[model samples]
Target: MRADTVEPPARPSAQAPATSVPVPARIAAHGASAADRVAVTGPDTTLTYGELDDRADRLAAALQAAGARPGSCVAVLLPRSARYVLAAAAVMKAGAAYLPLDPATPADRVEYILGDAATAVVLTDHERAGTLPAGPWTVIDLDEPRSLVPAPQTPADPHIGPDSLAYVIYTSGSTGRPKGVEITHANLANLVDWHNAAFEVSSDDRASQVAGLGFDAAVWEIWPPLAAGAALHVADEGTHRSPQLLQDWLVEKQITIGFAPTLLAEQLIAAQWPAHTALRTLLTGAERLNRRPLAGLPFTLVNNYGPTECTVVATSGEVGPEGNHPGPPSIGRPIPGTLALLLDEAQRPVGEGEPGELVLAGPHVGRGYRHDPERTAERFVTVRTGDGETVRAYRTGDRVRRLDDGRLIFLGRLDDQVKVRGYRIEPAEITSWLTQAPGVGAGTVTVLGDESGEGERELVAYVVASGDQPPAAAEVRAFLAAQLPDYMVPAHVVTLDALPMTPNGKLDRAALPRPAVVAEPAASPAGESTDDVKVWLGELIAELLNLGQVGEDDNIFLLGGHSMLAMQVVSRVRQRYGVKMTLRQLFRGPTVSAIAAEVAQQQQEASA
Candidate 1:
């Protein structure tokens, strides 16, 4: 992993995955990393820097032989494993861009991405191979030895330049489909450089990978540590899903650097951080961070803000300690080399007190959305700089006002799109799904509840029935649950006679009615012994959400309990019961009565 700047081997000979001092990763020459350090680690697997470099070299030679080259898109559908890292590195080594696809996504979505990106090859495990839609892609199964058997035992570091595409990450589109953002190697390198400098990344640091492959944040997770000669601990699916398990995993791995989405970060911050926790830095982004960081945290928490168009991060701020925060912390200034412009609706610079669109211009900004020339032209525009040089910039839809102190304060989105639990989502996408559902005619999804120092802001779907009876709320909920992620699914689907509209025929957002609370009450646990525990849990949950009362049978999330509130529950339960209640258990059984049962089980086991 040591930066061996000596001219790279024209064709670095590949042995089977093996590493010694001087790892010599293909990216290592350009990336200041150490060779002997552990490059990637999973729950059961670890790949040394040298091994990772060699394996990627071997695989890159194979990919080049199989008709892949620079500018080609190679999709990887493997889960979070050593192979996932190997495949991504291999693609880059082959001078081709890596297209990461979540195997958990619906097949149709996967198919769309493959075709849209013109994927040249697919590197996946046997479990996911059978499901890939047939295409021009040369499918290779990681489980099968034959996939790598024919590869030339050498590395092919093709002529890769900064402008060459590095990866294409798809984000939710306003038009009901996802748009792929094309990022180049230069963009990646710039981000890696900024990350290393900002965090003081080093070979001694152990970073954790929690973001899924399909996410852009995964780029930050995979690259910086490897480039900085650090060990990257891959969080298993369970650990990534369960805040309780993720915290424990970080401690067990002695992770020093970690990144999580806004929702999960809140829970991790609020949790009972073990005294031995080794995490020193935590990076969180992707949604609004409302909670003031708590005191006594061992790590420095940085709230980052960025659009996928601008690599992974744009601005970052280390939140102040408890009780000293002036307000919701600002997004801070731009990173080194990036320029943030606050322009008003007229394209003129806005005053410090005025809100304007945050336009970003830098080497880190992505090449623009793939295959969508119109959108690319609209979003990524060329502007004359103060130095009289022309540079491309991305128009971020986020509205922000600059403070007199030079920091930027984030105002809510200026469009219909909203971020729910760290996922950038379009209400139109949900409405599109709803309008397609049986018995639903016109549908509109809007955010409800005040988020600023108030209740949880949640999505509400208002629908007009196509048939005599409006679609059953449960039926609509089930329909969405089948096709979309949990975050995209509306908590309540309200049926109305007709959607309220303005004189101009647009939906009047302010006139949307509140969701009628029609959820059938869950049966309360009716035993005498557990009543006290249930009552206590109920009070704790009620206090967290500021509800009048939380029934023993009620689901917290249904009653507007988001990840932030859920963490408060976990924290409060631990303080009261001296029991470590997990986020997984809460998700499994959110009701107070059910949690009381889990607490009892954990206690009995601990005693045993």
Candidate 2:
């Protein structure tokens, strides 16, 4: 530990104000008070406060008639459009908490979540409603002609209280099943108050909603701006992953407040920000903040840390442009109305400078997992603080050390869970699926190697065959693709006769061997292309993948392409062709031929 690693004694206090109002009430206040303000802005449409409020009111009446009651779970599973915002507000207007499901999620995962959540009604557009897996619930297409008109009569307030259920977000669980963290209106109010007060959001501020609805950060992205009477701009599809495109978008929109995952923030920090950039504040969390003390940025760079169980943000710190810290940067101190306690295995506070499991308790804490009493009891505990006051808190499985000065430094995880691209993944989730696959008796999955070496985190799996011959690594990957999302598919799959175990019968994680490269089926050659652009782009993509051959139509993501790889491809395109391609363009046109065609069109337009 360095000498300057002192705790921040003056960290923000967690004394939240007493509030009897729900989050919707706050929004309703804004709607009445700031009716002309831009409430929600997206690429295709925009909603003013009055417009959003009226639509929500009309839709709420229809929802109540359709049997949506208070405390019911109404799922909003639409694309990031104006309809998405309307559906969310309308669900709350109907006196029910809304569950947001990202349309990009795999069908299997969506099915599991809808069933587990006991969703009362799923609100989606006409195009997407048919795509949803048939479930034993009502699927209302919000785009239907009848839904365009709100029901007659102004619906009375459902009397949503501070203690009522607000939202239920699903997160990775240690036991292979996904757990839903039930956040109450009071928890949201605590976060909204702290954020609005801390950031000083006003009508001049334009906040960006870059996070997908499925992410807990979306909770923060949506509420704070609306509550502060600020404009909330929703980024279009394929904008979240690519840092360069997202940075350009932020600058173009003149957004004052924005939130991104840690990786993208690091990229933006490294980028050459425009001198007159309107972006004022960049808030990042969801993963560890590796690149600290950003250099030469005309914005307030805030590193926030929290889990789904504790609203969105528990601790947040703003680093200066100097980016110079005495030691390894920490996740910062507790946010307002939140407490961070470091305890040993016995739940006793550790000595100064010692590391222990982190426990978070405060007004921002949620109401624990939905319908999971056993898990709720285990993780959410009532404990006595050092001041001899008993309070309810959530036991975060993260390890951290409290500095002598008062701040807390994050160490690492105390469990097998890992975060990849800001998504919390349980190794057990992968191992459980591996064991169920045919010809597999038992299996183990590990996040292999250091994250830096692999460009990104790689989920590696080792499975012992139940038959005479072990299955091929490629074979297992294909099996997993149908059931798992693209991200959950292992980067490398290895076959083993048996796994090494210790004398005590516990599997020794250190003994697991490094995974070898898995052989994939050979791709057919790209036909003799006289077009130089096509040939150049194909070779560039092949070089990036280290593959022997890449067809013009080969999908980059399907062929093991990641965000880092995608960035490299874009960089090469800019270097060779002078065509500025967006990440969304790459996502839409993932093949070498498709990219070359896009580049060719740009050249044609330039010449014309």
Best by lDDT: 2
Worst 10 residues of 2 by lDDT: 517-526
lDDT tens per residue, model 2, 370-422:
88899999999998889999999999999888766566767667875687766
Point to the candidate with the largest TM-score.
2
lDDT of 1: 0.73
What is candidate 1's CA lDDT for residue 586? 76
Please, what are the lDDT tens digits per residue for candidate 1 over residues 67-154?
7888889999988887798898888888888998876667998999899888899988888999889999999888888888888888
* Clashing residue pairs, backbone N/CA/C < 3 A, model 2: 7-405, 7-406, 7-407, 8-407, 14-337, 293-323
- Measured with C-alpha atoms, the lDDT of residue 324 in candidate 1 is 64
Which pairs clash in the backbone of model 1?
Answer: 1-23, 1-33, 1-34, 1-35, 2-34, 2-35, 23-35
Q: Mark the regions of model 2 whose C-alpha exceeds 4 Å error after superposition.
A: 1-3, 6-20, 147-150, 321-323, 416-594, 597-608
Candidate 2: C-alpha lDDT: 0.75
